[model samples]
Target: MGDRPERIADVEGVDLAGKRALVTGSTSGIGRETALALGRLGADVMIHGRDESAGEAVVDELAAMGREATFQRADYASVDDVRALAAAVREWTDDLDVLCNNAGGLFREGKLTDLGVEYTFHVNHLSPYLLTAELLPTLADDARIVTTSSGAHRGVDIEFESIRSVDSYSGFRAYQRSKLANVLFSNELARRLDRTDRSITSNSFHPGAIPGSGFARFLPGPLPRLFAALGRLPMATTVAEGAATAVYLAASPQVEAVSGQYFTDCEPETPSAAARDTTTQRRLWEESATLLGIDEPLADVEA
Candidate 1:
């Protein structure tokens, strides 16, 4: 936590009073900003991150704003940690109104999780997938699942075999593929929820090119310096701006009936051809469920 107290800014035309939201990776950057924004709009916000002190600081900030808030700590790299997080969330609330999957990063040196999945894929995709499935029973009928995807996913496609194999791993490629998985996961999840008559909406968004938001800090070399310099340039998006679309999807009434869409800058946008493939979306969903050992169809898991 920093010496300065957290700043609370009011967002107009949005009121989340009586609603509950869980925002992952809220220790800093866009995730932190998003959580704070939700709190400003009067949501009961649960801020999550691996750092206990930072998470507690955010909880304190939200509490100061007269919002009900709590902190939960979990490392996304471990499946067991994800399960613990989901269980803790269930204990905290019986019905969740918003689930923001905003925890992710680039692993410069390729590594594998204990489950043998590539580190980037495991954290950025599989962990959120598993967490969302495990918490399905607690979601409200009109709950929003806002996944923080990336524009970097434009050309990448999911490589099921490669996600578990690091023989020729490239960190950038793995991250891109994981972002693609976010979009595909949202797509398939929306379809399944529709079939099951659940009003839950699933959507993913590109947070824009945010340079100071931990996206480049993990780069192996001068790339980090390069990105840092670029972040100071006038064209780069700030953390607050990067969080707008997610906040929009989470609280806006215009999208109340919208689902299975890719969004950028608070507007529905078409994803890459690969991301739009129905068959591929289905395959990715089923494969993700298989990898997570989830036997139930996720759409039917509601309580």
Candidate 2:
């Protein structure tokens, strides 16, 4: 699923020794690879996931690399849980240098969470939105924010009303909308950060189809088996290949002044017309804050 494997060495001067980073959903797959790559390059990483054991295992692995690591557990379906994660991170460090909003997945059923939002959208889009708001003050000046979007975002456009409840639901469609929201939220965040005169840059990327990332486990019936088989194919995208753009966005000096862009294989590319709509971007940003019941962050950005 990858065109060319992008390596950490591809980006020069990527040493992150004095940086502190947090990667959500770091327990496995692309998230794990992204977190580890950052740690290996010298960023002390905070790992997050629902599984305590798996989360701690990542932390321990990072520790062995001599990078300070901590594990924070939270359920993306719960707003309080997401807030608690950011609060816990605040207690650990005040100068977080890199934030990878890499958590989220496709849910089999489209049901509403307690937050009255569809499960997939809430977990993949809203949770990260809330977490970013909660942790804004904690981010270091010039910190990097990288969100893991997907090429799946290409064809879908989000319906703000439908996020509250889906009547005729298709899992794949829900996933596509959520991914599109990732791009919109990311681009909008970059605009807001810049308008506010903040140096924090926000960007998102498509990590090619990674069949081996254990993501196939969520697929229905025989599809999981099909994906498992595809994972072993010579052309299957490796987890490292899937994680490249994230590492590039997180640590590369090339993008130091770059923001609000969609990327593939470490190079900026134009997203779908729907994804690039600044009108939709602002709409999504406002709707997200309303759903989370929080005052819009960086009020000055919009003022």
Candidate 3:
């Protein structure tokens, strides 16, 4: 998850005027680059993070580009903070054209949130689910919803017996579980959207790793710099390059009619065998809804 995946060739001639996009974790690295690109394409962008200073800096960068951009702060690790984010979004606008669940955190040690949930799981997985659910009503017809996932989701499976990882704990393993949850959530979300009146399309992508971001969060000292240098060679792509697929999903015409599938480089790629198991995905989705106290059927909601 520390290296970039293959980049999707950029699409030619696209426009996204009058569109409003909200990208979480957008204050730096790939998220920042993605938001900037979308702004350049004429979308009104909302940048979010826990860091107000960094968020304002990104907003300044976008404004300098002559694009409409604003910053919002919310701690994705806290459910209360997520609720506050939803409230803030409501105050901004009732209609949304796109929502990119790009915010996430990485943890190497065992820590629990105030809610007693695992920190990594709540930040990376639950926060996205809650935010998406909160914003579902605001999405316009044919709107796009993209979630940033990781290639590390390859072999992980949701362990229903221990959703919070109270017993077994490894930073990488927990992250993998959260990512796998994202793909399953995307698929199930598409099904829900299809059953509803709204034509909002939900999809997820493995945005390749950008060297100074999450993966380096716990890298030991100079080791991060060393790996980043090596990654500059044949291994890693720049944040802009890494975010191409996400940008494609957000605005490209290539996937206008495509939804629910896992993507890498703007192409449909088969997910891990575990991810393809519908039964497991459904169970995970149901369990997640229960955990989040979502009683409404996914299909009953208007997109």
lDDT of 2 by residue, 1-303 (tens): 223223632653468898999999999889998898888788899999998999999999999999889999999999989989999999999988999999999878879999899999999999999999999999998999999999999888898879888799999999999999999999999988988656999999998899978787787889889988888899898788898889888888889989999998788889999999989998999989899889987767672
Per-candidate Cα RMSD to the true structure, in Å, reads 3.7, 2.2, 3.5
Better of 1 and 3 by TM-score: 1
| Residue-by-residue lDDT tens digits, candidate 3, 44-146 | 8899997799999988888897777888889987888888888887777788888998887556776777766777778888888889888887777888999
- Top-scoring candidate (lDDT): 2
Residue 252 CA displacement from its true place in model 3, Å: 0.8
Cα-lDDT of candidate 3: 0.78
Instruction: Name the weakest run of 10 consecutive residues (lDDT summed) in model 2.
Output: 1-10
Q: Please give the CA lDDT of all the candidate structures.
A: 0.86, 0.89, 0.78
lDDT of 1 by residue, 142-226 (tens): 8999999999898787978787788888988999999999998888888888876679999999989888776787888798888
Of candidates 3 and 2, the better by TM-score: 2
Q: List the candidates' TM-scores in order.
A: 0.93, 0.96, 0.91
